[model samples]
Target chain A: MELSQAARLDQAAEVLPAALRRRVLALPAAERARIEELRLRGGRPMFLLGPEGETPLPGTEITAQTLETVLEMASRSSVHTVLDQVRNGFVTIPGGHRLGLCGTAVMDGKTLVNLRGISSLCLRVARQFPGLASEVLPKLWQDGRLESTLILSPPGAGKTTLLRDLIRCLASGLGCPPLRVGLADERGEVAAMAGGVPMLDVGQRCDVMDGCPKAVGMAALLRGMDPQVLAVDEITAPEDVQAMLQAAGCGVRLLATAHGETLADLDRRPLYRSLMADGLFDRLVLIQQTDAGRRYTVTDGEGRPC
Target chain B: MLKLLGGLLIMAGALWCGVSAVERLRRRVRVLEDLRASLVWLSEELTFRRSPLPKLLEQLARERSGPVELFYREALAGLSQDPEGGLQQSWRRAMVLQLDFLREEERQVLVEVGKTLGRYDAGAQAQVLAQAARRLETIRAQAGEEARGLGRVYTALSLAAGAALVLMLL
Candidate 1:
């Protein structure tokens, strides 16, 4: 069975050093469910970043050894195996929980070779909201074909969570005809793949290229996987836009996410503006975190509010 | 008849003691050689394939045998049993428990290998494993030499001790 949010929090905590794990797990189930991230810094009190605010766990001072042990346990004692991710300053655990690391950088001629002497770890618990795309999915289709769509949100606004559900729904044919989705999961966050199998359910027809750079994986997926849709997270690089444009040229629809609160916000960035000028995406879903809950707004390519 | 039987028993006991002494020396040499071979294989795998430590240890346990196999199996078991203690603790524990035949110096080489196995990048780990294999090779060479020399001495000493006892008794 898939784990509940609180259970996932507990599962992520399992990788923490023993004492910290116990302290984090001791929270009320309600509080555990609300936690978004866990921050542990050497010589500082550990804090749980929840929806409310940063809640510090008093008297729990993190040490360098604690950070090392957590990394060791999280990597299953194979830090060498995940050195590529370590070089990127974060390591994603099996269940898609991401551990953002802070440490002294080991460099090789302007390149980050690895991270050593870790001082802090921010563990972001990955949650699956399977039905989050239900309302947003119907609006993305025009006639029999799905439109190229882009999900927009500020960081920590559940953009990845929504993208994951959208892919699952599209591939599973929950609300639309099932399409083969080629996911370029650069950091392994979208699929949380382990040994060629996704730890999280992406869908029956989803083909994930895990831990590959978005631009390269998308091109490879387009060439080999014959995907009808290419879904990528965080369109941050120019190479990623070029790849997406190439895929769109082949009539393969795209489902991608970008860091933005609104369509206007995306237009301010030269990279996003150029992609928009190409008319690559026909639909945009902007996610806003509200007092009540998260609000999803679907807009046309022209930025007309729905 | 009783005296003849006692003499026979003395000779048989002496032969058994001599054989056992020779076997212990041979076993030590065999163990060291096997361990060195396993480390070499591990180093290659880490450098080329970059397989995870647990999976590699599992493969080592499955394909190998004797003290080398036992050592890997115990280390793998340690990881599963008490993961919070991490690989270093598990590896050190496994070495202390399973590598009793190794000299203090030989075991110390393994202990150093344990400390670096999973803590660094593939290049670093591969280098450490290669160094360990070299150290083990040196130790095994010395052990092989000693086994050839000391093995005969131990057998001969046991044989002489047994003969003298039998002579006194007779």
Candidate 2:
């Protein structure tokens, strides 16, 4: 069967495996050609064409049929699952595609149950953008070893992307000996792997526990994996703090991310506040996006410019 | 013949109530399923990549469509409109909005989720999740018992009314 236009786009970014990409792209020329044309033009053009090219783009255009098909195809080809179906309009695909669905949602108090007449879907494809860690690696390895680091960024600022690249660099030993890395991919975002193997490189030296809760995964890694460094994504819960502390206590250097626009943003959050107060992380890295590109800034635990 | 007419009326009423109750239950189940799916999505987005929590939360809020959208919208509004209110205040407002829509058990689960997001600790978050799961189990058991009781009552009422009508006719 022919892959949908969204699958084609995912293939281009290498989010879809090579074998699957070929299978998806190898359909009859007419269908493949249509998706290729749309892929070349990007999300906006494909969106403009609408499903079956019958009508103008509605406010929310993803249909239930489209979502179900895409999801089923992705799941069949990959090891990921559908984690959540948002009532307002989104289906959280396991390998990190937040397919924004457009529909009317039925609500019971604060919780939503069903979405009817899905109109549009924005499939946010997840990719591990490499080459970022090279810039920050030197700063992190102060004395010929990896230092405990904290990555800070606003949403979509690419903290996970950078961390993934860092893990790859450290694990593969791009230039140096491979380092054993433990990745607690609590959300299945980092590896974006289908089964056990990662769709993204994320380095050869890293052992990943996908979809496991962060704390349990971390403790497991410490006890079982014996990783040289421990990495996790977004720390917001107080329990996550305790886990990080526990990992630190185990003598495993920490690498993680937190939400904040600036160092001052850290002061307002209790978890970040306590981590900062305790001086848990040896180095703090800030990422900011600009028209030029993503800029990285290094800082100490005290939030001083490094 | 008069007695038969009364029996028919009673049967009609019972069927009507039965269908209505079934429909209500179905709707509730659908809502719960959707909410559960959304929660899974929330967990994925929050834990997947290392996006900053506030930024991620704001993005989620912007992308929110269902009932929880309001919570996200309020969080976004609080962040943008009341920058001085601080993260805690913004978070609290969002949680409050969420609490309004959630069942008591779901609300408790969210409170713990909020706490986990506020801090960067994984173990603590896991603990809260385990506790919430336990509470959910209790709620499910109670709901099951209540549903069973309701079903029995419905069956008894239908049978008793049918029997009484037959006797009156005889």
Leading candidate by lDDT? 1
DockQ, all models: 0.76, 0.01
Lowest lDDT sum, 10 consecutive residues, model 2 chain B, at: B117-126
DockQ of 1: 0.76
What C-alpha lDDT does candidate 2 achieve relative to the native structure? 0.62
TM-score of chain A of 1: 0.95
Model 1 reaches an interface RMSD of: 1.2
In candidate 1, what are the lDDT values of residues A1-306, reduced to their tens digit? 377899989988988877788888888998899998999999999999987778889989988888888888989999877888888889988789999998899899999987768988999999898899999999998888899999999988999999999999999999889999999999899888878898777888999997678999999999899999999999999999999999999999999999999778888999999999999999999999998889999998998864
How high is the CA lDDT of each candidate model?
Answer: 0.90, 0.62
Model 1 CA lDDT for position B12: 80
Question: Which residue runs does candidate 1 get wrong by more than 4 Å?
Answer: none
